[model samples]
Target: MLTVMGATGNTGKKVVELLLAAGQQVRALGRSEPRLGALAAQGAEVLAGDPGDAAFLTRAFRGASAVYVMLPADRESPDYHEAQRAKGEAIIQALRESGVRHVVALSSLGADQPEGTGLLVTLHAQEERLKALENTNILLLRPASFFENFLDALPIIQHQGINADAVEPDHAIPMIASRDIAEVAARALVQRDWSGIVVRELLGQRDLSYREATRIFGARLGRPELDYVQLPPEEMRQAMVQAGMSETFAGLYVQMTQAFNEDRVQPRAGRTADNTTPTRFEDFVAGLALDSANP
Candidate 1:
């Protein structure tokens, strides 16, 4: 059995689907039983509980051949770092207790640094904790900024006619679709061919700047004149807080953008076929256009 945490989330749901389609027994974990109903209907053994509870996770992980682990982002948490750390620690403890020999963990590109990566610091710590597991094979998937993140900008672009963020508009960075990350994670869970710890960077099809991605969005939405504006850090933080994120998480979000702008957070390995995923920003934007149009 392959156990998947965050089973109802974007990547996790897709990972569950992929595993089930491949004829694997999957234990899908989520916070809500109702939310997990869809996966349960699809022939997965659904386990609903708090990921921060080690005992719950231990029960879910037991008897599984491999597990997919992640700390889903919580922008509303008053202390995002503390919350993520708690979940990370619980996951590690459960993994040790369950004696799962193989794990495929979702992480970020900047997780190599112990500090200054803002929200990514949790992932860095999680990576270290996973590495300490004796007699376990762990694959750390370090993917780029997600393409789905741009969907958040759709409203701003539709109402204000511009894309905005704290990152430099012209500073190209790797961005991937979450489904692509799920694809990698699913394959790794099934193969389990590697021994010990392995770190893989999943860059998108290519590096793209905010300006470039905005242009792609404009072309899809029929707004050739649309532009991307690099918002001031404080301004963006306030906007994020107004959009319902906690003040602390909003501040960390801006700090993470600063790290991106300064090149502190980036792909450690240069782009290669092995690391470059197939989904392009254009493809993701196309789906975004369809969703917005239908919604």
Candidate 2:
């Protein structure tokens, strides 16, 4: 059996869907009972609980041969880094107890760094912990900044009439669709394709900038002349805080953007068909525009 954490999230749901379609036995888990019920009705063994609880997760991991692991992004956490570390530690402990021998970890692009990657430092720390597990075979999927992150800018654009972030407009970064990440996760779980420790970089169709993204969003929304602006670090942190991120997480996120602006964070491996994903920024923005119109 294959178990998936964050089963209600974008990547988790897609992974579950793909696995179910492949006629695999899946245990879908998340904190939301209502969401888990939907997966249960679709023929998955659904569990709803806090994954940070080692005992609970141990039970969830029990009887599964492989598991998809992630520390879901939680902006509301009062202490984001501490919370993520706790969750990661719990996952490690649970895996050790349950004897699930294969794992597909959802990690970020800059997670290779031991420090100075801001929001990614939590992931970096967790990756190290996962790497130390002797018995478990681990595959870490280090994906680029998700294109869906652009959705967060919709309100800012609609209200303020500009595209903005702490990262400079000219800085191009690798971006991927969550669906692509899910595809890799589902395949890794079902195939058990690699032994020992493996890292796969899932870069999107192209390197894109907020400036170029602004043009796409404008074109998709019929705005024609929208502009992209780089906000100061403090200003960006305040904006994210007001938008519901904790002050600490917001500050860390700003630092991550700074790392991007200064070219500190980048893909560790060269591009290949194995690492590239198909979805384009245009396709994502088009879908986003449709959702906005329908909503």
Candidate 3:
């Protein structure tokens, strides 16, 4: 059986669906009863528990041939780094105790550095902790910043007809769709081809700047003159905090944007066929626009 953590999340739910369609036994883990029941209805064994609980996770991991480990993003956490560390340590213990042989950890780009990569610092530590698993083979999927992140801007766009973020507008950043990340992760979980610890950077089709992206989104949404605004880091942080993000995570997010603009946080590896995932922003935005129009 394959156990999937964060099964109620975007990528994790896709992972469960893919595994189930492949006729694999899937155990989906999450804390929400409604979501878990939905997965149960979809042919997965649902285990509802806190992923940060070592004992619960150990039980969930037991007898699994492979496990997808995704540490869900917590914008409201009082201490995001400590939360990441605590969850990482718990998963490590669960992996060790359950002897789960294969793991696919959902990591991000710039996870190799000890500092400077704001939100990714904890991911670096998690990678190290997973590497210490002597008997387990692990795959670290370090995907680029997600395109789904852009959805947060939709409301702002509707209100102001502008796309605003801390990300540098002129910088051609590597952005990927969550579906592509889920596809690669599912393939890795199914194939189980690698041994030891492996890191794969999942860069979407090509690099795209927010300037280029805003134009495309504008065109798609019938707003040809929509503008991309790169808010000042402090302004962005304040906006996010006012929008319900904890001040701590908002600061970390601003730091990450600073790192991005400074070129500190980037993929250390070049793009390869296996690492370059399909799903261009244009195609993704087309679907997103259609969904929004219908909904």
lDDT of each: 0.91, 0.89, 0.89
Question: Which residue segments of model 2 deviate by more than 4 Å?
Answer: 289-295
| Cα lDDT tens digits for candidate 2, 1-295 | 9999999887999899999999999999999889788889889999889989999999999999799999987788889999999999999999999999999999988899988989999999999999999888999989988887776777888888888998898788888899989988998899997899988888998898989988887787778688999999999999989898899889889999988988888887767777889999888877764554421
Off by over 4 Å in 1: 289-295
Tens digits of per-residue lDDT, candidate 3, 183-218, equal 988988999999999999889889999889888888
Each prediction's TM-score versus the true structure = 0.95, 0.95, 0.95
lDDT of 1 by residue, 1-295 (tens): 9999999987899999999999999999999999999999999999999999999999999999999999988999999989999999999999999999999999999999999988888899999999999999999999989887877787788778888999999999989899999999999999999999999998989899999988987887788788999999999999999889998899989989999999998778788888999987888877764554521
Model 1: which residue pairs collide? none
Q: How close is candidate 3 to the true structure, as a TM-score?
A: 0.95
Displacement of residue 68 (Cα, Å) in model 2 is 0.5
- Residue 39 error, candidate 2, Å: 2.0
